[model samples]
Target: MSVFTEAEIEYLRSQLLARLATVGVDGRPGVKPVGFLVDFATDEFVIGGYVGSGMAASKKFRDVEANPDVALVVDDVANIDPWTPRGIEIRGRAEAHTTGGAEIGERLGSAFAFDAAWIRVSPRRIVSWGIEGSSFEFSARDVASLPTSKGV
Candidate 1:
């Protein structure tokens, strides 16, 4: 009962960059397009949430704690042309960082294109995947959502 097929999930995991949109304490939805790595060739996303100074990066983390349910979307920008690659949407839970998960920061530090740290997100369910012509979708409750992971 998932929106994305096996191939779609595989494609998501293969991609290197995705937008992590988090709600700040102020209830504002903060969106940042960043790089990520899918470990074990699965849905285990270990990332770095480091970027910009005092931009309130921790705001996202606080949001995650306040609301564990999160949306992790990694999609290619749509171009006017028809032949460009399509985009993907993944819905999942974000694990807040801690002293133990600091290692994930280092792991994603080099894998990502950015010089700052990264935050890990585990997709419990995929919401959608498609190009300009078509699209597919899924949800966390759809298939029991993604299991709690260690990446965060």
Candidate 2:
């Protein structure tokens, strides 16, 4: 089953960056702009950064380690004159992994190093608006039940 409609999937695929939010052990919140890929097969969002470098030592990774709960927002204004705003908000649990020689690195393209670390987020809830007059929310179960498709 597909978690998103074809149009929604197309919108996601067309966009390159999203804002990822995580909470730290000290109860502080952090948000960063990250390049992401939507894995239609797993219905998850994937992001990678160089490991054993400044990225690995960054606070965002630390925050994810301390609190797996997170949120990601991908949005843009379609127009300025009439004011059409559209985007999707994803609330989910994130799992961090070392991407050494992992296929995920390749999927992320040449921008990411081969040994980069990555985070895969499994969404629990998704809310979307402003695409084709569509506005709705879906739970994980609801998403899982939708028919699956071949591409992102």
Candidate 3:
């Protein structure tokens, strides 16, 4: 097993969006399931105005405001694609975007709802495993091999 190949990285971005967001509040940690839309164009994950944004998302925001450290797990539960039986867990810091935040300087986040912020993955570490048979693993760094949008 190795780090995510160039191809696998993009596939993961294009295929899966169901994410588990971990947020800690009042010294108690919680995991919330949420639907995220991955934007390959800018290599960013966006969450918008939706009702079932898991539990304590707003609270999580407050938590992030207090503590920037966070964790994320994005997976393909159906095993439908080549990377099927594979999931990636990212451990990194997180920051909540205010109306006039630096990166939030754009309108993308605030577009859909009052809380559309980008989950900037700092990529402290990446671990991917093969869920199919048993003996598979991968570790990937930056998306160096990712192709840019030329015609598309």
Q: On residues 49-132, what C-alpha lDDT tens digit does candidate 1 reach at each position?
A: 443432225666667766666777777644545534466665677766544334554554444233243445666665554532
**Model 3 clashing residue pairs (backbone):** 2-138, 2-139, 3-139, 3-140, 85-131, 109-116
Best by TM-score: 2
For residues 1-152, write the lDDT of model 3, one tens digit per residue. Answer: 23444654665655535454555666777665654554444454444434234323567667667676666677654445544466667665564554332234234433333233434434355666653233265655543423322211
Tens-digit lDDT track of model 2 for 19-47: 99999999988899987888777788887
lDDT of 1: 0.57
TM-score of candidate 2 versus the correct structure, residues matched by position = 0.81
- Positional deviation of 66 in candidate 3, in angstroms? 2.0
Which whole-number lDDT from 0 to 100 does residue 32 have in model 1? Answer: 67
Error of 3 at 38 (Å): 4.6
When summed lDDT is taken over every stretch of 10 residues in candidate 2, the lowest stretch is 143-152
**RMSD in Å for all candidates:** 4.8, 4.7, 7.4
Ranking by lDDT: 2, 1, 3
- Please report, in order, the local distance difference test score of every candidate based on alpha carbons: 0.57, 0.73, 0.49
